[model samples]
Target: MSAKPLTAREAYQVLRDIALGVRTMRRLGEKPLTGVYSGMMSV
Candidate 1:
């Protein structure tokens, strides 16, 4: 597997995007993904 290394700012932006996506999914009633995100965040 090939992984691209992101700069700190780039990584932060990616994380922010993911956070927004998860929040939106949660608001839209995506229970499975919302549970996954909540579980991961608690860790």
Candidate 2:
């Protein structure tokens, strides 16, 4: 399927969300050292 491109505001919001997610992970990816890490991950 084909769709039109997002408007400027829409694109900004989308990118903002992605950036926030990355920033959040970067800030919390390693710390505390008190959690079980099996073989899978979910959010």
Candidate 3:
């Protein structure tokens, strides 16, 4: 069966939820964090 389409508001809310989850995960250090270095830096 085909799924029902979501309204614009619903779609926006879904995306917002995903962004919040990602931020939360970063805050919790559940994923490997990365940072950018300036100038010649050693790895």
Q: What is the C-alpha lDDT of each candidate?
A: 0.53, 0.53, 0.51
| lDDT tens digits by residue: candidate 2, 1-43 | 5558788997677668768885232222344444465433322
Each candidate structure's TM-score, on Cα atoms with residue i matched to residue i, is 0.41, 0.46, 0.46
Model 1: per-residue lDDT, tens digit, 10-42? 767767877887433224333455453455321
* Model 2 spans > 4 angstroms off: 22-43
CA error at residue 25 for candidate 3, angstroms: 13
- After TM-score superposition, the amount by which residue 9's alpha carbon in candidate 3 deviates from its true location, in angstroms, is 0.4
Give the C-alpha miss distance for residue 23 in model 1, angstroms.
10
Q: How many backbone clashes does candidate 2 have?
A: 0
Count of clashing residue pairs in every prediction = 0, 0, 0
Question: Model 3 Cα displacement at 40 (Å)?
Answer: 39
Candidate 3 lDDT (Cα, whole model)? 0.51
